[model samples]
Target: MPSYKLTYFDGRALGEPIRMILTYMGLEFEDNRIDMESWTALQKEIKWGRIPVLEIDGKEMYQSRAIMRYLAKQAKLAGDNDWEAYEIDCAAGTVGDLIDLYRSMWKLSDEKTKEEWEKKLLDEFIPSFMKNWDEQAKNTGFLANGKLSWADLYLHGWVETLEVLMGKEIVNEYPNLKLGREKVHATPGIKEWLAKRPKTVY
Candidate 1:
Protein backbone atom coordinates (compact mmCIF):
# COMPACT_ATOMS: atom_id res chain seq x y z
CA MET A 1 0.00 0.00 0.00
CA PRO A 2 1.11 3.56 -0.68
CA SER A 3 1.87 5.92 2.21
CA TYR A 4 -1.09 8.13 3.10
CA LYS A 5 -1.15 11.23 5.26
CA LEU A 6 -4.30 13.29 5.88
CA THR A 7 -3.90 16.86 7.07
CA TYR A 8 -6.66 18.99 8.56
CA PHE A 9 -7.56 21.12 11.53
CA ASP A 10 -7.66 19.64 15.03
CA GLY A 11 -11.39 18.93 14.80
CA ARG A 12 -13.72 16.60 13.03
CA ALA A 13 -15.39 19.04 10.63
CA LEU A 14 -14.76 17.89 7.05
CA GLY A 15 -11.77 15.84 8.16
CA GLU A 16 -13.64 13.29 10.26
CA PRO A 17 -15.53 11.71 7.38
CA ILE A 18 -12.22 11.26 5.55
CA ARG A 19 -10.74 9.70 8.65
CA MET A 20 -13.74 7.41 8.98
CA ILE A 21 -13.37 6.38 5.32
CA LEU A 22 -9.69 5.59 5.76
CA THR A 23 -10.40 3.73 8.97
CA TYR A 24 -13.27 1.83 7.35
CA MET A 25 -10.88 0.68 4.64
CA GLY A 26 -8.36 -0.38 7.31
CA LEU A 27 -5.69 1.75 5.57
CA GLU A 28 -3.06 2.93 7.98
CA PHE A 29 -2.43 6.64 7.38
CA GLU A 30 -1.00 9.55 9.32
CA ASP A 31 -3.75 11.70 10.81
CA ASN A 32 -2.11 15.08 10.95
CA ARG A 33 -4.02 17.56 13.08
CA ILE A 34 -3.05 21.21 12.97
CA ASP A 35 -4.21 24.07 15.18
CA MET A 36 -5.82 27.27 13.85
CA GLU A 37 -2.70 29.23 14.76
CA SER A 38 -0.49 26.92 12.76
CA TRP A 39 -2.97 26.78 9.91
CA THR A 40 -2.04 30.36 9.00
CA ALA A 41 1.57 29.53 8.23
CA LEU A 42 0.72 26.09 6.84
CA GLN A 43 -2.03 27.54 4.64
CA LYS A 44 0.67 28.65 2.24
CA GLU A 45 1.73 25.07 1.71
CA ILE A 46 -1.75 23.65 1.10
CA LYS A 47 -2.57 23.49 -2.61
CA TRP A 48 -6.10 24.84 -2.36
CA GLY A 49 -5.72 26.68 0.97
CA ARG A 50 -8.40 24.29 2.17
CA ILE A 51 -7.64 21.13 4.01
CA PRO A 52 -8.67 17.48 4.42
CA VAL A 53 -5.94 17.00 1.81
CA LEU A 54 -4.79 13.41 1.38
CA GLU A 55 -1.10 12.94 0.59
CA ILE A 56 -0.55 9.62 -1.19
CA ASP A 57 3.03 8.50 -1.60
CA GLY A 58 4.14 12.17 -1.20
CA LYS A 59 1.81 13.49 -3.97
CA GLU A 60 -1.04 15.70 -2.68
CA MET A 61 -4.69 15.63 -3.64
CA TYR A 62 -7.45 17.96 -2.51
CA GLN A 63 -11.22 18.13 -2.03
CA SER A 64 -13.08 16.09 0.58
CA ARG A 65 -15.64 14.58 -1.80
CA ALA A 66 -13.01 13.61 -4.37
CA ILE A 67 -10.85 12.02 -1.71
CA MET A 68 -13.82 10.13 -0.28
CA ARG A 69 -14.92 8.94 -3.72
CA TYR A 70 -11.44 7.65 -4.56
CA LEU A 71 -11.02 5.94 -1.20
CA ALA A 72 -14.58 4.55 -1.22
CA LYS A 73 -13.90 2.88 -4.57
CA GLN A 74 -10.80 1.29 -3.08
CA ALA A 75 -12.82 0.09 -0.07
CA LYS A 76 -15.72 -1.20 -2.16
CA LEU A 77 -17.99 1.37 -0.56
CA ALA A 78 -18.89 2.78 -3.96
CA GLY A 79 -21.84 1.38 -5.87
CA ASP A 80 -21.65 -1.72 -8.06
CA ASN A 81 -21.89 0.13 -11.40
CA ASP A 82 -22.05 3.49 -13.14
CA TRP A 83 -25.76 4.20 -12.69
CA GLU A 84 -25.56 3.15 -9.07
CA ALA A 85 -22.59 5.44 -8.57
CA TYR A 86 -24.49 8.32 -10.17
CA GLU A 87 -27.46 7.69 -7.89
CA ILE A 88 -25.18 7.63 -4.87
CA ASP A 89 -23.54 10.85 -5.99
CA CYS A 90 -26.94 12.53 -6.29
CA ALA A 91 -27.90 11.46 -2.78
CA ALA A 92 -24.62 12.69 -1.38
CA GLY A 93 -25.05 16.02 -3.23
CA THR A 94 -28.42 16.57 -1.61
CA VAL A 95 -26.91 16.06 1.83
CA GLY A 96 -24.11 18.45 0.96
CA ASP A 97 -26.65 21.16 0.12
CA LEU A 98 -28.33 20.66 3.47
CA ILE A 99 -24.99 20.86 5.28
CA ASP A 100 -24.18 24.19 3.62
CA LEU A 101 -27.54 25.64 4.67
CA TYR A 102 -27.11 24.28 8.17
CA ARG A 103 -23.65 25.81 8.48
CA SER A 104 -25.00 29.19 7.42
CA MET A 105 -27.34 29.14 10.41
CA TRP A 106 -24.32 29.14 12.72
CA LYS A 107 -23.26 32.56 11.48
CA LEU A 108 -26.28 34.23 13.04
CA SER A 109 -25.66 35.59 16.53
CA ASP A 110 -28.95 37.18 17.53
CA GLU A 111 -31.65 35.03 19.07
CA LYS A 112 -34.22 36.28 16.55
CA THR A 113 -31.91 35.62 13.60
CA LYS A 114 -30.98 32.23 14.93
CA GLU A 115 -34.65 31.39 15.52
CA GLU A 116 -35.47 32.33 11.91
CA TRP A 117 -32.70 30.14 10.60
CA GLU A 118 -33.79 27.36 12.91
CA LYS A 119 -37.31 27.70 11.61
CA LYS A 120 -36.10 27.39 8.04
CA LEU A 121 -33.95 24.43 9.04
CA LEU A 122 -36.78 22.55 10.77
CA ASP A 123 -39.81 23.76 8.86
CA GLU A 124 -38.34 23.70 5.37
CA PHE A 125 -34.95 22.10 4.90
CA ILE A 126 -35.25 19.12 7.19
CA PRO A 127 -38.71 18.21 5.95
CA SER A 128 -37.66 18.10 2.32
CA PHE A 129 -34.28 16.33 2.31
CA MET A 130 -34.62 14.23 5.44
CA LYS A 131 -38.04 13.02 4.34
CA ASN A 132 -36.66 11.95 0.97
CA TRP A 133 -33.70 10.18 2.59
CA ASP A 134 -35.93 8.60 5.23
CA GLU A 135 -38.26 7.21 2.57
CA GLN A 136 -35.38 5.65 0.65
CA ALA A 137 -33.73 4.36 3.81
CA LYS A 138 -37.01 2.74 4.89
CA ASN A 139 -36.96 0.55 1.80
CA THR A 140 -33.23 -0.04 1.93
CA GLY A 141 -30.97 -0.21 4.97
CA PHE A 142 -28.62 2.32 3.39
CA LEU A 143 -29.02 5.78 1.87
CA ALA A 144 -28.32 5.06 -1.77
CA ASN A 145 -28.47 2.13 -4.25
CA GLY A 146 -30.00 -0.18 -1.61
CA LYS A 147 -26.51 -0.92 -0.38
CA LEU A 148 -23.90 0.55 1.94
CA SER A 149 -22.11 3.23 -0.10
CA TRP A 150 -19.93 6.24 0.56
CA ALA A 151 -23.15 8.29 0.43
CA ASP A 152 -24.37 6.48 3.52
CA LEU A 153 -21.15 7.32 5.32
CA TYR A 154 -21.41 10.97 4.22
CA LEU A 155 -25.01 11.26 5.39
CA HIS A 156 -24.30 9.46 8.65
CA GLY A 157 -21.35 11.68 9.54
CA TRP A 158 -23.21 14.88 8.67
CA VAL A 159 -26.34 13.77 10.53
CA GLU A 160 -24.26 13.08 13.63
CA THR A 161 -22.59 16.46 13.20
CA LEU A 162 -26.00 18.14 12.96
CA GLU A 163 -27.08 16.39 16.15
CA VAL A 164 -24.05 17.83 17.94
CA LEU A 165 -24.68 21.32 16.54
CA MET A 166 -28.43 21.33 17.27
CA GLY A 167 -27.91 19.79 20.70
CA LYS A 168 -30.44 17.05 20.20
CA GLU A 169 -31.19 13.84 18.37
CA ILE A 170 -32.84 15.60 15.47
CA VAL A 171 -32.64 12.73 12.98
CA ASN A 172 -34.74 10.59 15.33
CA GLU A 173 -37.76 12.32 13.80
CA TYR A 174 -36.92 10.36 10.66
CA PRO A 175 -36.75 6.82 11.98
CA ASN A 176 -35.44 5.22 8.80
CA LEU A 177 -32.66 7.79 8.51
CA LYS A 178 -31.78 7.18 12.13
CA LEU A 179 -31.84 3.43 11.60
CA GLY A 180 -29.76 3.66 8.44
CA ARG A 181 -27.20 5.80 10.22
CA GLU A 182 -27.12 3.29 13.04
CA LYS A 183 -26.34 0.59 10.51
CA VAL A 184 -23.44 2.64 9.17
CA HIS A 185 -22.22 3.23 12.69
CA ALA A 186 -22.28 -0.52 13.30
CA THR A 187 -20.01 -1.28 10.33
CA PRO A 188 -16.90 -3.06 11.65
CA GLY A 189 -14.12 -0.50 11.48
CA ILE A 190 -16.54 2.44 11.77
CA LYS A 191 -17.89 1.25 15.10
CA GLU A 192 -14.39 1.12 16.51
CA TRP A 193 -13.52 4.52 15.03
CA LEU A 194 -16.58 6.09 16.65
CA ALA A 195 -15.62 4.52 19.98
CA LYS A 196 -11.96 5.55 19.89
CA ARG A 197 -11.72 8.65 17.66
CA PRO A 198 -11.11 12.05 19.20
CA LYS A 199 -14.25 13.89 20.27
CA THR A 200 -14.82 17.29 18.64
CA VAL A 201 -17.70 19.73 18.56
CA TYR A 202 -17.54 20.07 14.79
Candidate 2:
Protein backbone atom coordinates (compact mmCIF):
# COMPACT_ATOMS: atom_id res chain seq x y z
CA MET A 1 0.00 0.00 0.00
CA PRO A 2 1.19 3.51 -0.74
CA SER A 3 1.82 5.73 2.25
CA TYR A 4 -0.66 8.56 2.73
CA LYS A 5 -0.69 11.78 4.70
CA LEU A 6 -3.63 14.19 4.82
CA THR A 7 -3.16 17.77 5.94
CA TYR A 8 -5.96 20.15 6.84
CA PHE A 9 -7.17 22.55 9.49
CA ASP A 10 -8.29 21.22 12.89
CA GLY A 11 -11.90 21.10 11.77
CA ARG A 12 -13.97 18.41 10.09
CA ALA A 13 -15.15 20.62 7.22
CA LEU A 14 -13.72 19.22 4.00
CA GLY A 15 -11.33 16.80 5.71
CA GLU A 16 -13.66 14.45 7.56
CA PRO A 17 -14.87 12.49 4.53
CA ILE A 18 -11.29 11.79 3.46
CA ARG A 19 -10.47 10.63 6.94
CA MET A 20 -13.57 8.51 6.99
CA ILE A 21 -12.63 6.94 3.66
CA LEU A 22 -9.15 6.11 4.96
CA THR A 23 -10.56 4.67 8.11
CA TYR A 24 -13.17 2.69 6.19
CA MET A 25 -10.52 1.23 3.93
CA GLY A 26 -8.48 0.34 7.02
CA LEU A 27 -5.63 2.45 5.70
CA GLU A 28 -3.25 4.15 8.07
CA PHE A 29 -2.27 7.72 7.22
CA GLU A 30 -0.97 10.77 9.01
CA ASP A 31 -3.74 13.24 9.86
CA ASN A 32 -1.93 16.55 10.17
CA ARG A 33 -4.02 19.42 11.48
CA ILE A 34 -2.61 22.92 10.98
CA ASP A 35 -3.05 25.84 13.27
CA MET A 36 -4.30 29.19 11.95
CA GLU A 37 -1.22 31.04 13.23
CA SER A 38 1.09 28.64 11.40
CA TRP A 39 -0.85 28.74 8.13
CA THR A 40 0.89 31.83 6.75
CA ALA A 41 4.35 30.28 6.92
CA LEU A 42 3.02 26.95 5.66
CA GLN A 43 0.93 28.37 2.84
CA LYS A 44 3.82 28.49 0.37
CA GLU A 45 4.58 24.81 0.98
CA ILE A 46 1.02 23.71 0.35
CA LYS A 47 -0.12 23.02 -3.18
CA TRP A 48 -2.90 25.41 -4.32
CA GLY A 49 -2.69 27.13 -0.92
CA ARG A 50 -5.54 24.93 0.19
CA ILE A 51 -6.20 22.70 3.10
CA PRO A 52 -7.01 18.94 2.69
CA VAL A 53 -3.84 18.19 0.81
CA LEU A 54 -3.33 14.44 0.26
CA GLU A 55 0.26 13.34 0.16
CA ILE A 56 0.80 9.90 -1.33
CA ASP A 57 4.22 8.35 -1.09
CA GLY A 58 5.75 11.83 -0.69
CA LYS A 59 3.84 13.15 -3.74
CA GLU A 60 1.12 15.74 -3.17
CA MET A 61 -2.38 16.26 -4.57
CA TYR A 62 -4.86 19.00 -3.70
CA GLN A 63 -8.65 19.46 -3.87
CA SER A 64 -10.91 17.69 -1.42
CA ARG A 65 -13.22 16.14 -4.04
CA ALA A 66 -10.31 14.91 -6.15
CA ILE A 67 -8.69 13.36 -3.11
CA MET A 68 -11.91 11.70 -2.09
CA ARG A 69 -12.56 10.37 -5.60
CA TYR A 70 -9.07 8.94 -5.81
CA LEU A 71 -9.32 7.36 -2.42
CA ALA A 72 -12.78 6.05 -3.20
CA LYS A 73 -11.43 4.29 -6.24
CA GLN A 74 -8.61 2.82 -4.16
CA ALA A 75 -11.13 1.66 -1.57
CA LYS A 76 -13.51 0.30 -4.22
CA LEU A 77 -16.23 2.60 -3.02
CA ALA A 78 -16.42 4.66 -6.17
CA GLY A 79 -18.79 2.44 -8.17
CA ASP A 80 -19.02 -0.74 -10.19
CA ASN A 81 -18.17 0.69 -13.61
CA ASP A 82 -17.28 3.86 -15.47
CA TRP A 83 -20.90 4.89 -15.91
CA GLU A 84 -21.67 4.21 -12.27
CA ALA A 85 -18.65 6.27 -11.34
CA TYR A 86 -19.97 9.09 -13.50
CA GLU A 87 -23.28 9.02 -11.65
CA ILE A 88 -21.44 8.99 -8.36
CA ASP A 89 -19.50 12.04 -9.45
CA CYS A 90 -22.71 13.77 -10.44
CA ALA A 91 -24.23 13.20 -7.02
CA ALA A 92 -21.12 14.31 -5.18
CA GLY A 93 -20.71 17.35 -7.42
CA THR A 94 -24.28 18.41 -6.75
CA VAL A 95 -23.58 18.27 -3.04
CA GLY A 96 -20.42 20.28 -3.62
CA ASP A 97 -22.47 22.97 -5.33
CA LEU A 98 -24.79 23.10 -2.33
CA ILE A 99 -21.77 23.45 -0.08
CA ASP A 100 -20.53 26.36 -2.13
CA LEU A 101 -23.87 28.10 -1.74
CA TYR A 102 -23.76 27.56 2.02
CA ARG A 103 -20.25 28.99 2.21
CA SER A 104 -21.35 32.08 0.27
CA MET A 105 -24.12 32.62 2.80
CA TRP A 106 -21.57 32.35 5.57
CA LYS A 107 -19.68 35.33 4.14
CA LEU A 108 -22.52 37.83 4.37
CA SER A 109 -21.83 40.50 7.00
CA ASP A 110 -25.32 41.93 7.23
CA GLU A 111 -27.75 39.83 9.21
CA LYS A 112 -30.63 40.93 7.02
CA THR A 113 -28.75 39.97 3.89
CA LYS A 114 -27.78 36.68 5.40
CA GLU A 115 -31.36 35.98 6.40
CA GLU A 116 -32.63 36.82 2.94
CA TRP A 117 -30.05 34.62 1.31
CA GLU A 118 -30.80 31.81 3.71
CA LYS A 119 -34.50 32.16 3.00
CA LYS A 120 -33.83 31.70 -0.67
CA LEU A 121 -31.48 28.84 0.07
CA LEU A 122 -33.98 26.99 2.21
CA ASP A 123 -36.92 27.80 0.01
CA GLU A 124 -35.37 26.93 -3.34
CA PHE A 125 -31.72 25.88 -3.45
CA ILE A 126 -31.74 23.37 -0.62
CA PRO A 127 -35.08 21.90 -1.55
CA SER A 128 -33.99 21.34 -5.13
CA PHE A 129 -30.97 19.37 -3.96
CA MET A 130 -32.97 17.43 -1.43
CA LYS A 131 -35.77 16.69 -3.85
CA ASN A 132 -33.46 15.18 -6.42
CA TRP A 133 -31.36 13.34 -3.85
CA ASP A 134 -34.38 12.06 -2.03
CA GLU A 135 -35.64 10.51 -5.23
CA GLN A 136 -32.29 8.93 -5.96
CA ALA A 137 -31.97 7.64 -2.43
CA LYS A 138 -35.43 6.12 -2.63
CA ASN A 139 -34.55 4.14 -5.73
CA THR A 140 -31.09 3.06 -4.72
CA GLY A 141 -31.09 3.04 -0.93
CA PHE A 142 -27.90 5.03 -1.52
CA LEU A 143 -27.00 8.24 -3.28
CA ALA A 144 -25.34 7.20 -6.52
CA ASN A 145 -25.87 3.53 -7.11
CA GLY A 146 -27.95 0.77 -5.61
CA LYS A 147 -25.13 0.09 -3.18
CA LEU A 148 -22.90 2.08 -0.90
CA SER A 149 -20.57 4.46 -2.69
CA TRP A 150 -18.38 7.50 -2.07
CA ALA A 151 -21.26 9.78 -3.04
CA ASP A 152 -23.07 8.66 0.09
CA LEU A 153 -20.13 9.76 2.16
CA TYR A 154 -20.10 13.14 0.46
CA LEU A 155 -23.82 13.58 1.02
CA HIS A 156 -23.50 12.60 4.67
CA GLY A 157 -20.79 15.19 5.22
CA TRP A 158 -22.70 17.84 3.26
CA VAL A 159 -25.81 17.32 5.35
CA GLU A 160 -23.82 17.63 8.57
CA THR A 161 -22.40 20.95 7.45
CA LEU A 162 -25.81 22.16 6.29
CA GLU A 163 -27.36 21.32 9.66
CA VAL A 164 -24.75 23.42 11.42
CA LEU A 165 -25.45 26.37 9.18
CA MET A 166 -29.25 26.03 9.09
CA GLY A 167 -29.45 25.58 12.91
CA LYS A 168 -32.31 23.10 12.58
CA GLU A 169 -33.35 19.79 11.10
CA ILE A 170 -32.82 20.19 7.37
CA VAL A 171 -33.41 16.62 6.22
CA ASN A 172 -36.57 15.81 8.08
CA GLU A 173 -38.86 16.68 5.20
CA TYR A 174 -36.98 14.32 2.92
CA PRO A 175 -37.29 10.83 4.31
CA ASN A 176 -35.11 9.12 1.76
CA LEU A 177 -32.32 11.63 2.18
CA LYS A 178 -32.59 11.37 5.94
CA LEU A 179 -32.36 7.59 5.79
CA GLY A 180 -29.54 7.72 3.31
CA ARG A 181 -27.50 9.85 5.66
CA GLU A 182 -28.35 7.49 8.50
CA LYS A 183 -27.25 4.53 6.38
CA VAL A 184 -23.90 6.12 5.74
CA HIS A 185 -23.45 6.66 9.44
CA ALA A 186 -24.52 3.09 10.14
CA THR A 187 -21.84 1.63 7.89
CA PRO A 188 -19.48 -0.19 10.23
CA GLY A 189 -16.32 1.82 9.67
CA ILE A 190 -18.14 5.15 9.62
CA LYS A 191 -20.14 4.13 12.69
CA GLU A 192 -16.97 3.43 14.62
CA TRP A 193 -15.34 6.65 13.46
CA LEU A 194 -18.32 8.77 14.44
CA ALA A 195 -18.40 7.21 17.90
CA LYS A 196 -14.81 8.18 18.73
CA ARG A 197 -14.05 11.15 16.48
CA PRO A 198 -13.42 14.53 18.06
CA LYS A 199 -16.51 16.70 18.37
CA THR A 200 -16.41 19.93 16.36
CA VAL A 201 -18.82 22.84 15.76
CA TYR A 202 -18.74 22.37 11.96
lDDT of each residue in 1-202, candidate 2, tens digit only: 8999988887777888888888888878898888888888889877678788888998998888998998898889998899999999998999899889988987999999999999989899998988998899895568877788888887786577678868878887888887877787888877888898777777
Misplaced by over 4 Å in model 2 are 107-111
Q: lDDT per prediction? A: 0.85, 0.84
Candidate 1 lDDT score at position 41: 95
What TM-score number comes out for model 2? 0.90
Indicate the residue-level lDDT of 187 in model 2: 84
TM-scores for every candidate against the unseen true structure: 0.90, 0.90
| Global local distance difference test of model 2 | 0.84
